[model samples]
Target: MITIRPSREGTAVAPVLVLAQITSLQLGSAVAKDAYDHVSPTALAGMRLTFSAMIMLVLVRPRLRQIIARQWRAVISLGLVFAAMNVAYFQAISHLQIGVASTLELLGPLMLSIVLSHRLEHLAAALLALTGVLLLTTSSASLSPLGILLGLLAGLCRAGYTVLNQQVGRLFPDWSGLAVAFAVGACVLAPVAAVTDAGAVAEHPAVLETGLGVALLSSLIPYALDMVVLRRIDTRTFGVLLALSPAAGAGVGLVVLHEHLSVRQACAIALVVLASAWSVSRSPRTAPVPSPAPVSAGDNLPIKDTEHQART
Candidate 1:
């Protein structure tokens, strides 16, 4: 994934990484959704974060004492954001269809892009995205208000994670900030989940396995790819490609959760996609720079380079 010169070859790789990141995250969400009956969302989220943290810790073994003193505040904040975003997303999927939940959550990044870009096209895209979200949610009266709220909350967390993670990435080595954040998030959630939902895992080891799978697919591989590919793409292009994630989530939900999308909803998704693509195609080119590499989890996962992708 190393690109010595920022050329067309390097640019071509960015979208592929983002696409892979989207696919892995949505598939992981389906797996986590399937496990919800045996384990509560909180428990599943806690387990996923804890297990990912453990894997990363074992692999990275960051110099905690030195790193902590250097950037403990940002590290701890990023971890909390990660934990909250995952919990909110799971809660949303519990009440709403995964497609709708994911579509709603994209609001965070859409808004972020608008704020950061300050481009009329981005503003137009945000409006288009809002229109799409309205189409997706209003068409189905069965959707839960609480679930939609939770998804929006998760989106907000995601936006914050993107902003803060950029700072943390600048402060630490490859994946070290992420390792610490995951460890901190795991430390925060594991005990509460253990006391409340330990029996679910004890009774069914499959839940643990599923969570581990989620961590691997959702957190480890995609984020690693994200770290590499992001350096070759500008933030504008990266954010625009992010429009693919909701569509991917919707597709995964249809296949896995048997969630169906209406014609209007599909149109809505398309509008958001078009808005992003249009904005990206119009934007002036910027030479990409290789940024720090870090592994992160789902939406709340630290995006060490470019914009942070939404966590499921």
Candidate 2:
């Protein structure tokens, strides 16, 4: 029998890299939140996407020619979704706590998983997540209704991104599709950037640096690390680790943003995380093996077919 196992390097590197990715993402959001005093939410969002797109374009240099005419719709849709998600995310954090916003936005992918799931465990998981989100949203007074709406909208856009990313990933290689999608996001936000008083961002050297840091930390570094980490870990392990995102957000929010969560809110976040892990754990693993082919009526046998059957 042949045995296959995860490589030693993968075993050691995957978890650490994923942790780093989560840390970078949450820390980047914290930095963006701090910079809000200097720039509008939309302006900051535009700066992040625009600069990140420029960086990705220079590094990836995606070949536009490789994208077929038929795939234009998918490419454009993915880009639009990306732009919408980020814009709503920034707007959400401006009004809501970073942790709260992230947890609510997580509803998108969680609901998507539940909708497509066939297992009872996954359904249970969905309910758990839903309850958690409701608790978090209802218990908070500081968050405005518009902020909550934007967070949910961001979640919906996130679900769209998840669905479309698979299609475009198949259509392009070397992550060029993501680069193209980012480019499209940059284009989509160009008007917003032009209209916003970006001069405030320009005048403050610290804000500009923070904007660049947000771009690199939030988009470029984490995404680049994700590509590498995905190749090194199994789907189950990856999904399980991804469940830590909300916790990471909350932890970072407390430390960096000084956002405090009540006991009930903390429990709700735990429920959401557990639900994500449970859903991933309950996914159908290996496929059932096929039965052996039936013996032909006319096939010669060591013993007669009837006699052999009786003996067995």
Candidate 3:
């Protein structure tokens, strides 16, 4: 169990971080969809991972020399998950309708949070979100069965990445955990994807620009903001706020991507927002204490970084 310190800074920083993560993710996806018009989604995904990885590598200077064998295993696992998640998700978005596909991608995290919360109200919230997802994904009567399968697999991969990150964050050094994962993901994706889309990158400069936008919106902004927030909130509470991500994506799509939501979709967003608010409100006002990992789990777990903040 993770103990929560009231982040003295979380009050000011958490919301900002949440907003940053949401908008960045939204713009990234929207920009990516735009990019697919020029380059294959695989190539675009590669570019985003590559650039984001570079930015963090330049800034953080992670202690590569001190890395342990176990840490290397953890890092590689996280990197593979991240790479698989990105490539599959980008491909799904390329094939399926954007709104439906995105909602699908979000399923893994939403389910994890709800299941892990183990609360009745959260169960209902999960159902609501799941129902909305069903509607969103299945509403397209002609939707390709193969596309849906790919999307759900991508969602599973995303869940794996998220779970691994939580544990990795406890051990690996700060954003270096994410940074290394993204770098490895980029390298793995680049050679295979770029070769196939070689002509697209050169033929369409706009394609490359879209990929850059995706990098900025998705990877670069969110990780830094998450670092700020992680210093404040426990992993569990952090997951709850993450539920708002899809709603943010919806808003972003409407404003920036010009993808309007139907009345039903609008209603779904309202339900998800309300449910998330209630889940957070009902949880303990003082953040839960971060428990030290079981001795059997490992001796090398990181000391949880806790900050005290004024209540919002």
**Which predicted model would earn the best TM-score?**
1
Report lDDT (CA) for all predictions.
Answer: 0.74, 0.70, 0.68
TM-score against native, each model: 0.85, 0.79, 0.83
Ranking by TM-score: 1, 3, 2
Q: Each candidate: RMSD to true structure? A: 6.7, 11.1, 4.9
Q: Which 10 successive residues of model 3 have the least lDDT summed?
A: 288-297
Cα lDDT of model 1 by residue, 6-56, tens digit? 446556666677789889988988999998889998888888889889999
Model 3: per-residue lDDT, tens digit, 195-296? Answer: 989998888877766777788887778765665565455445565566566578777777766767777776666666666666555544455323223222
Which sections of candidate 1 miss by over 4 Å? 1-12, 68-70, 229-237, 292-312
Off by over 4 Å in 2: 1-20, 224-243, 286-312
Query: Residues 1-312, candidate 2, lDDT per residue (tens digit)?
Result: 222333456645666787798789889899999988888888777878888888888988876765555456777898898789889999999988888887778777667766765657766777777777778667767678898899999878867766676555444546676788878998998678658856876677677677789998887787667655544444334434454567788899999989888998888878777866675555443322111122333434422212012321
